[model samples]
Structures are given as structure tokens and as C-alpha cells.
Target: MAIVARGQADRGPPRDRCGDPDLDDARDCRRDRRAVVLPRGVARRRQAVDHRRRVAGRRGADAARRAGDGEPAQGAHPDGRAVRRRERHLLHRDGGQPGHAADHRDRRHPRRDPRRAGHGHPGPARALVGRCRHRGPRGASRMTADDLVWILPLIPAVAALAMLAARGRATLVWLDLLASLGVLTLALVIAGEVPSRPIAAGPLRADSLAIPFLLLIGFLAVATSIYSNGWVRHEVAHGGMKASSLRYYHALVQAFIATMLVTVLADNLGILWTAMEGTTITSAVLVGFHGDRRGLEAAWKYIIVTTIGISFGLFGTILIYAAAAHAHGAISDAMSWSEINTIASRLDPGIVRIGFIFVMVGYGTKAGLAPMHMWLPDAHSQAPTPVSALLSGAS
Candidate 1:
């Protein structure tokens, strides 16, 4: 009985061993082994819990710091926000902030990011992104035919400054303007029945179908130019553009005029269509020149609508070519307006009607007819008064 009692005492807890009273001492030995292993497992689990608590506490402190600083709480990783905050905090700790120092040593020799501190760029990456977001439309203003008269000359002048240098610098602008005016005057003189070269032999075609249209365009261009000088001067006075932008404006205006004149004088449908499309591109920038919301919107609408209409005209021109091929086995004859009219009776009426529909619809949009005239009022109202005058008159 004494031996049994001693064994039972050595066994430790009964549940810890197999149900064998004789093997109670074995159970006690096993209990002793477990005591050694259990402490290591418990210590490891405690260490894990302690490590997790430390990490959780650090996250909470970082979150609190961000909240107190009025910064966005980016997650635990060191992202752009975190980096910016650290930089700002360092700057503050060094002395107030980076830009606050008047004659501070660091301020005198400021550290700058290469991207932000470029020759022209003077802001942070985020600031640059913001500026890009705020940037307005590409095409803001409507450039008229008269506007081109000034614009085309300036382009060569600017180019000459780089290319021709001494000689070009002396006379590029004046020469270009004079030459453009001379060409325009020659065209008009020829149209007015003044004696000139064989090229002028095409009768002022006075009573011709296109004569009235050509004369109208010419008169409008002249009137618009007179108005533009005053309007542009007013814009400069009102701070609408810098000197550089004004120079660009003047040059583009003349180029635009040249394109319109070409469109009017084009004896071939292909040439007419090409000139009209050129006019659209040149005028688009003028529409958005003001860099305002309304100006940008108007410019966008005008470009899209006119481009779509012109595409239809292009398709019709191709169809006309196809018709001419079918009728006379000649594509070049189809391009000539005079030939097309003369052969109109012999051509497929269906094809002619379709082509005419396209021409009218396409050119009519430019002509400011209803339905497609949605862009017209906005373009006219937002554009400078001179541009509006040309659009109303010449277009």
C-alpha cells in the first residue's frame, strides 16, 4: 500500500497518462518530459503575440500621426504620400518649411528635383498633373480668310529667322505680306476682266456659276481684314494674348485667307474639297485662341462637325470619280467641275443625285445651314468679332 501511494504521487495528474496504475511512474517520467517541451511552446506563442501587438501599435500610431497632420492615411507601405509627408516634416524640422527662409543657408542653395526644376518647369509633379488637368482645348478660335492674310506671311518670317537669318530677318514679314497681297490683287484683277496673262483668260466668267460666289468671298475677306486689325488691337489691350501669341495669330490669319481664296478659285472638285479641308484645320486654332471654357467647347464642336461633313464630301467625290469611270472610262474628267456639268445629262442620275446630296450637306455645314448649324452660333459668338464677320460673310 505504501508503494502504491508513492507511485500515485509520482504520476502527477491522472488525465496526463494512460489508465495503468502499475505504469504510474512511467506517466510521471512522461509528465516531466512534457513540462520541459510545454514551456518552449508557450514561450514561442507569447513571443508571437508580443510581436503582433508591437506591429498593431506601430500601425495605430502612424494612422494617428497622419490624421493629426491632416494628411491622407496611406496604408502601412511608404508610398508617395508618406514620402511627401516625411520630406515636409524634415523641412519643417530643419526650419519652418523649404520656401519660408529669406536668407537661410539651405534656401540659398536649395535642393531641387530634376523633373520639377527644369529650365522652364517650376512646380512639383503633382502640380504639373493638376495644370495638365486644367489645360483647355487645343482649338479655341475661328480663324477667317482675312486672318490668314496676316498669318501666312508671319510663318515664313519666323522660319526665315532660323534659316535665312540676315537677309530673311530684314524683309521676310513685309515681303510675304506684300507678295500675298499682290497675288490676291492679281487674282481679283484677272477676275474683274483686267488684261493679264493667258491664265487670266478664263472670262471673269462674269455670268459664270462660280463668279458671284468668288466675288462674295473676296469682298468678305477684305471687310474682315479691316475689322480684324481693330479687334486684335483691342484683344491685346484687354490682355487676351501675349506678344508671341498675337504674332502667331497674325500669321495664321493670312494662311487661312490663302486657303479660302484657293477654295473659291479651284476649278476642280478635288482641289475645292482639299482647300476647304485646309481651311477647317487652319481656322480651328483661331476658334480656341482665348483659352476659355466656352471658346474651347465651340472650337471642338466646330472641328468635329465640319470634319464629318467634309468626309462625306470626299466620299461623294470618289463616287463621282466612279461614275465618270463608268461613263467615259476617265477618272480625271470626273474631277473637273466644267466637265462634270457638261456630262451631267449623260451621267447616271442616281449617282449624280447622291454626289450632289453629299456636296450640299458637306459644304452646307460650312455654309452654316440649319441642323448642322449647331456649332455656328457658338463659334460666331465666342470668336473675335472679325472672325465672326468673316464666318458670316465669306463662309
Candidate 2:
């Protein structure tokens, strides 16, 4: 037998540790055919290495085909020491590079019994192997808290639809109460998911600022629904309001509540304004539901005053959108709270100041602040008890 020097090709077929050439090839083929069972931490590394090798091999094969060579140059010396070394490096990254994960199989003792390998810990071993799988950073595709929390606004909007479909006074009353209860329950569930700061999804957001306010709305919505049942009965019994009018009132109140819910959940200032305007339209009818001259006058005042304020808010929103486009280079980015907050310091100071002034004048009127408070008392006093509660508590 001629002994070959290191790095030289052995003058024979590749043999296993037992000196059988067929055994090594057969064992390797079996290992390749069988699924690789490895510890979770090492499995990921092996998968990555395997993927890279497959890609590289595909590229090499394509190049060989393009060059009119069916076989690669490396195929000439498959059993050479250099070829085996390269193959070993390609197949595994276990040569102790600091960045590469070390395989745990090389340890002197098994961490757990080999007999119970595939079957999980039978006697309180705590399943250490499976825990490693989930220990990595969360993937980008994972759903965010905002994705799950948006159902809060939808609950009230659905409630509004049910109110519009109610057949009679009794049905309207029960539907209103049930919808309010549903809104309250959903609000509580969403509030629990919110953290101290705002969590956002597209144009909607929930945070410490919105959650407390939403909780108040939820309570008030349910409370007013319960109270309105008796109030509607009193109005109808005394011939104060027609049955047809009460049904419209029920529908309008729910739409109003849905608008308020959307307003609080809005991440974009534009959405907030739209939802705010929605409240005005829906509640104006409720404000003047009594059909008296005084109620009608109050509702007109509420509409006229709020409309002016809303116009100012609209101008402000447009200016801000322009500024946002100028600052961030996109019209849509201008409407995003995340984008605006990110580049706020870089925005034009003059534009920002004017925009904020309009915003204040517009939203302040809706909030019943200072001079805008004129329509507040008249609208609140003339409106029904439930409508008044909603305007006072939510709007």
C-alpha cells in the first residue's frame, strides 16, 4: 500500500473509519436522505449554510452549462483531500468561527437521555430544546398590537348599523342598549392592550391619551342608552315626541357615538377632522329633535358655528399636509402621524405656527372652549338627555 502525504489525493476510493469504501458512501447517502435532527439553535445555522451552498452550487452548475461543459472542473478530483476539505466547509460552519453557532453534539455527555430523544421530556425536564426555537427576534411579518386593537372603532360603527335597522320603538331601545354594552366591552378590551404611549396602525391609534377618554365614552354610552329608554318613553307618553322622531333619534345617536369613537381613534389629523364633522351632522338632527322653534334655532347655531370652526380646521389640515409633503417629500407621508412626528423639528416654523393656530381655533370650537362655548349650552340644553350626555361626555 502506498501511503499518500497530507493534502494529496489518496490512491483509492474514499473509505470510512472501518476501512470499507462502500460503507462511507452508503452511510453518507443515508444521512443525506434522512431528515437532519439537530438542536434548535444549531438547526437555524445549518439551514442558512445549506441554503447558501445550494445557491452557490446552482450558480456553478449554470456557469458550467453556459460554458458548454457538462461537468465542473472540481469533478476531476472528487476524492482529493482539498476537495473533501472544501465540501466539509460547504456543508457545515462548525469550524469554530466566533460568529457561527457551535453544534452541541460534540459535548462529552448527552444533556438528556438519547432513548427519549424525539419524545419530549416525560418527567418535568421543562422541554429546553423547544424553548430555543422561539427565543430569536420577532419577525417583521408578525402582527403588531395596533393591528389587533383596531376592532374597537368597528364595534361602535356596527352598533350604529344595527340601530338604523331596528323595526320599532322597543326594538330600537333594546338594540341601542345592546350595542352600547358591546361598545363598552370592546373599549375595555382595547384599552387593556394599549400601553402608556400611543400605538398606531395606518391612520388610527390608541395610547394613554385616548384610552382613558375612550373608557369614559364607553361608560357614558352605556349609561345614556339605559337612561334614554325611560326618557324616550316619557317623551312618547306625554306626546312630546313622535314615534317616527324617536326612531330617527335612536339611529342618529348611535351614528354620533360611532363618529366620536373614530375621532378618538384617529391617528391622522385629517381623519380626526372628518370624524369630528360627522359628529356635527349626526348630532345636529338630535339637537333639534324636539321640533320646537328653540330646538331648531339651537341646532342651526350649532351647525353654523361648528361649520365655521371645521372650515378653519380644514384649512389647517391642508396647510399641514402641504408642510408634511414639503418636509417628507410625499403627500401621504404628510398625513401620517409617525412621519410628521419623525420630521417635526425639520418642518417650516412659520407654516407650523399658522397651521397650529387654525387647528386650535377649529378643534377648540368643537371642544366647547372659550368663544366656541356659545353653541355648547344651547345645543346641550335643547337636545334629549341621551344626546346631551353624548355631546358632553364624548364629543
Q: Largest TM-score belongs to which candidate?
A: 2
The lDDT of each candidate is 0.59, 0.74
lDDT per residue for candidate 2 within 1-395, as digits (tens), equals 22222322224555677777765376555544544345666666766898999999988865665566454334312211122332334333435432111121222123543334321123333334643332455764766566645666676677667766667888888888887888788778777777655667768887778888888988998999899989888989999998876667877887888888889888887788899999899899999989899999999999999999989999998888888889898876689777898999989989989999998999888888897889998999999888888888865
C-alpha lDDT of candidate 2 relative to the true structure: 0.74
Candidate 2 regions with alpha-carbon error over 4 angstroms: 1-148, 196-198
lDDT of 1 by residue, 1-395 (tens): 11111222344444434555545466556655452323555667767899999999988886676667556445322221233333344444544544322222222223433344422233453323223323357887674333433333244335323323323222434443443455445446445542332222121122244445545655655566555556666777789865446555655555666666666556577777888998888677778878899999999999999999998888888778777768776776667666666777788889878987888888888877877888888998887776666566657
Error of 1 at 65 (Å): 99
- Of candidate 1, the 10-residue stretch with the lowest lDDT total is 197-206
Scored by lDDT, the top model is 2
TM-score of predicted structure 1 = 0.52
